[model samples]
Target: MEFSLLGPVGVATGAGELVLGPAKRRSVLALLLLQPNITVTIEQFMSSLWEDEPPAHARTVVQGHVSRLRQMLAEGGAEAYGVELVTRGSSYLLRLPEELIDAHRFSGLMALARPESAPQDAVSLLREALGLWRGPALSGTVSGAQFAAAAHALEERRLAAVGALATAHGALGEHDHAAAILYAEAAANPLREGLVAALMQALYRGGRQSDAINWFHRTRQLLGEELGVDPGERLTRAYEEILRAEAVATQPPARTQPPARQQPSGPVDPRVQPAPERAQQPSIPRQQGHAPAAQGRSPGSGTTGGPGGTDSTVDTGSTGGTRGTGSTGGAPDRSTAPRFLPRPPARFLGRETQLAELTRWLTDTGSGESPIAVVTGPAGVGKTACAVQWSHRYASAFPDGQLFADLGGFGEGAEATPTAVLREFLLGLGTPPEQIPPSADAASALYRSLVARRRVLVVLDNARSSAQVRPLLPGGPGCATIVTSRSRLDGLVVTDVARPVPVQVLGTDEGVALLGTMLGHDRVAEEPDAARALVALCEGLPLALRAAAAQLTARPRWRLARLAAALGDERRRLSLLSAEDTGIAAALRNSVARLSADDARLLSQLAMGTGREVDALAMAALAGSDPERARDGLDRLAEMHLVDEAATDRYVISTLVQLFARDKEAGEGGSPPASTER
Candidate 1:
């Protein structure tokens, strides 16, 4: 049996196409096929089916769809081909090889076509890939907002493949063929500057210099009027090249048989060549004036830019450069660019899955807009560490340099205001200090204009809310931004389409490995059981694990069992997990201190409950409040990561967090009010 998601979701057997039931069932199959061999959680299915507002019985509905799909597959002889719909825990997995899915085949072909050494092979592979798209992806399937987003992403991939195919043809001296392919695609996607630039290049090379120049002017006018931004560096370079005298009169290729491939090519112009690394956008021509520095200053220096540039102190003066004009009147020297990422932790471990997701988001060619990813979790779950590590690993992708800022959302001081961050970003991007706009809106516009044409990564750490990160986001497709926050920032997900990546605690094995990395392998090996026990006591939190490992390392004579025993005591565990500057207790305390009195009281009461989980009704009985109030309090606690919603309304507080809450409760001598308790 073969699956198709390139158009309508379907299953095909030797007999013919099988009849998949209802629209929702087809949608379920489509979602599963898109992520073949991976688990699609029930929650994800519901979200994609109904979007933000799911029905109360969404679980039952999703289970029905899955059951129907399984029945259809089985009747269609999917078992003969080794297809299986397996239920794993709270998720469902559709087990199928990559070859069985058309979308996967297309992706595979595109990957094989990316190398510069294989233009002929690329042309063949890309042609096959393009032929697989029967129509708009997942067409005629049930549509929801989430499903629409996924379908849009698939369509974007198809267009990118088209662009790549044309590039491959051009490399083989088939300019007319490239021009024909790009012409139709460009008309279909007017906002795609990369496609537009490719078409312009093809037209100029095909002896239509005047027509190419006309297209450039039309594109520039459209982009400025629609997006309020000029044509990107690639398009601008193409226009400049066309203005040169020698480039005006190249003869058109013969309309007969195509010329044979030859190896006499000297140096290829980088501007005209397709950049497989950034297939969604045309490659920017290398300019002569600026070379990015190898390293930049640490964040929070009140100044950002190349070495020895002026500091980015906040200025409230009305006198500044015009909006959208990156003036350099008082700007720092442009010899060095700002590289603000902090060095990643030496002993970083785990998060392999999350790193892969981030990589895909950064390199995805389907979306025409700049990608935004939000890394969120409780304090010390390693959100920042994971982001920094990935940024450093892929730093070379953004040669223009990385920009880093600490929003101070959960730290000691006031949160870093968006205006302040924008100011620093503009300065770091070489906008003169005097030319920086005083208003945040104007500064943001200027910052977007400056980085619109460059490939850069902006890491916004500890963002308090969506509004805080919004102004800092770059406008164009050439950049990607990663924001780490304790809050989930749901508003950003809904409004700005930011991808939310929740970082969870490590598993037992991962926690143990981290301890081994921090402490000596021999030491952990000496007391393997004790090391596992310590990990359990620390609850697999990176900060707690690091703290425990630091204490043992500082006192080499202390046995791992002794440290484990110390952590076993609930009353003293928080203190035991504090070593040097790393303190899990301090972090929890800070989070609690920011909460309202009612929320704090609710959290403490819930922490004292007998079982690991509690529903809103039980919480209300315990807290002597109505169910509505109890539910609201629980949601607030969950948002702050003090309590996690294990399943629906059932909430689970981690052992370590419970201990902190209990400590506070004991200190306050708090208990349920006599009238409120059952």
Candidate 2:
């Protein structure tokens, strides 16, 4: 359970209730939880907790309470739920997901149970919202006027929920139950005209017209005495309709617009736009005659269903969704096809074997297994580029079009959530944003249904784990999914029978060809030996080669030998292989950022190994742990492609990764890395 502002203020866990120390402390936490994820200043805490007579050192007192609260939350491992208390200058923010707060969750349920929603769903949603309240709102935690007012507001909302619940019940033709629900709430809030109206309507619908008239009269008198006002429009309408013995509508008729065929997420939909870079990014290639992409596109849009090209209007987080040339036009309306494949990163290098294997796997899926290609390799080895290049190469094979999502699996940013990705995928595939359900599993079902027999290519790039990719995988054997990640994604292979396609760095000749293409052939032809040195220095990594080639292209006067010599210095080597702030160092930093602190420290330590190939015993000595622990860490690191097992017990720390680890060691003021490979 999360914070329970509807009844008492509390922070709870799976175990039991947490003792929230003092009343003032509970008050502080209650106020923060009431408005989670927003800045709450010390002054607001003081005002809410003490009102006019706060202590002289109120700020210090509030700060102490927050400090202790932070420690308490940390001890509970609240970070697992993405909950944390952040400090912003003079204010404090209690950040947590919406579902973690009872108030927010209740409010979300209430919003979900719209008058137009299905009666059963609305009833269930309303009852769940009502059940969140245990007792009087903030009963034990209200220290001052502010908390009392907050409690009053919540109680008022509860009355509205009760009325809505009654309306939902009536929609299901359970008029007796509706009258019962409204009676209790109406009695409690006699002056609430909406509840009074609902009670009247429910009573009449249950065939108690006289009882309905009597209740309305009682409420009318109470309202007059309380505020000297006549009954509101809702109350008057219900009363007039009942006197005529007419059946009155308790709420709007249930929506018949096919669910999942339109926006149903109501509010707070997690639909993702393409990654932020697409704003100014050059449009990726479309089929030869396809309409040009709308400028802002936004990649998260565009899902091609299958053979019929079941398409949807794409929303690229901008004014217009990308429109393909081959749109359906008619007298009623005209809609264009949606495209989601990203542009080729650069001129693709040699990956014919990898491409052939991908084609072969999909072809072999004739055995009835849906092919999910788990493309794993070291960072900067061109896994995404290879997949994209192949996708572009075989566009004709899947006329339904391609769907692409950058999972943001490995980077400084938060991982792209499955629900968020599913929303985007559904939006791309043909589902409207409103039809995209709030539930990850539900949206995923919609995805499977939409793509059941479609030959769409679902490419999930930069995935972090198998769990992240599982829900996004296409269900039909007619469709295929290509998942690229630094991790091997072994879980997918075991459970989903996914084929593992490993992409390594380019060959020396392949690297030269790619670099020569980026630079001019004349330049490489002029200094063939230096061109070879440039590729060799980069270990044939396409990303590194691209970065180097891009730089030389920028400075045409700079000789390949000069750039090659600069890269030879181990100190500047990683830094030299960068274009536009994205280099080997940055990629390594992102990869290390995802590892455990111990694993990261072990990585730097491993770089200090005695030789390129080291056994578990040697790693144990380097990591200062026993053999078993060292071996386990090595296995994990190898899974992430940071190290490779060269033999039964020996591992090879590639020269590039080694340099990155050593650089990290020095930057952090650790013992200098071994003069050479450890």
Candidate 3:
């Protein structure tokens, strides 16, 4: 049996291809195939399928698709072929050998080809790997948008392999073949400096000097117009080489002489050559139809004659490092200063205790290393808002700039990779794109080196795990890092000495204050009871309160009680608490989505069970599991802020979250008997 997601998602057997159902079903299959032998949670399926706005019945629909897929695979002799779709705790896993998946095979082949010692073999292997692509990956799947980035990354890998193959060809002196392969790719990705550089070099070596120069000018113009930046060092160097070649070609044969001798070794002037790390200073490119400037002159030193005999002195300090005939420098000031922090919310309230705790942790000097704080809570609990507000308030303490990144751990799209985050951080610190290393480890090392001794504040938001934030931490004692997540991040606390500061939902008074801030004080004061009732319905979650306030503000004539009345319905309250852009339901959904299958099932079961608090024994009865397993699942829920361990052996679920669970359980048409053990 063979599974393919490189193009249309499908299963193939020795007899024939199995009948994969509609787009949604094919999407499920594609997602499972993409990560074989791993359980994909129902929430993940729903998120990928609907892109963060799954319908109320998304879970049931996903279950139906999975069932149908399993039946189809069984009918196609899946058991005999060792291909099985198995159900686990709260997720489903597709069991298959790595060799059976084409994408996996392609990845393995690419990995083998990356080493330098086997260029010839790499060329053959890469060619074979590229041949596996039938068309756009997961093209026929319903959730194509969900896999758009993955498809693009896969295509990028293919193009990179093409580049590698061209290099191998060039190593064998097949310049024409290399140039041919690069031309198409270069044209397709016109702004790719590496591809353009490779193509330009190949063209020049293949005796197409004029064509290479033309390509350079065209690409430079396109980059300047589109990106508002000049080409990087690689492209500039390639262009300079072509220009030198052109200069030699056009010179009179009889008058031609050997090139000038190299400048004598001496103490390099600071103005002429900045520090090695600051080597990203942009060089002046000689204009076409103009006489080239004299070489070996100090940068920003003396005026030189241009094509029409005009004085052209390079301005070394021009912003973005562009050169022109001006005395002021063109290079950007504070090239290493990154301003990545997002703007703080306009009406952030509460979290005073959490903020004070974070400030204490950050200001403490005895820890002997840079301080790290993890701000964790359930979704919509204002963790991010609190972190941002505190950072802004204490921005003066850290004289250095603040760095921020949303890891997107729970985003509808693919989570941000550490390598990509490191690259962004490096660039933010004024590290030249060319200087930034390709690997995550190397980039992280460079980042630590840059931020060493700098009093910088780093905020890593929406982190999924400790591993994602670990690489981004600065090693300097003066630096401080704040991480916000739905997870408790106990690992960071235990291993990295990070102080844990949990951001809880607002108190009743605090919630009212927040609502008043958004909807005006008089309106909230005019109907205090109604406002409190609305706040109660929102469960004191800042996101929910703000959403309710927005809806009230939109309908000024509608009394606060009217809004509360609409929210009084348990079935419609979650939907009612939402406004145009903010919603309690959406925020709660993100938290629930992060739960494991068993944990999620237990949560729903508890929601359907009687009473606000459930003991371990009672939960065990509800889940039909042992007390230990039930306690473990409940503990996991508590860690996620989905439930509260109110006392010893007593757990309480939030009323709003309970509503969400009830909706989930109701959709599945199952309800455990009310707990009586407690």
Candidate 3: where are CA atoms >4 Å away? 1-336, 668-678
lDDT of 2 by residue, 93-157 (tens): 99888788888888899888874468889887887787777668887774577887888898888
lDDT of 3 by residue, 586-617 (tens): 66666676666677778888888778899999
Give the Cα lDDT of each candidate: 0.72, 0.71, 0.71
Residue ranges of candidate 2 with Cα displaced over 4 Å: 1-337, 671-678
Span of ten consecutive residues with least summed lDDT in model 3: 289-298
Candidate 1 clashing pairs?
A: 303-312, 331-432
- For lDDT, the strongest prediction is 1
Taking all chains together, each candidate's TM-score versus the true structure is 0.52, 0.52, 0.52
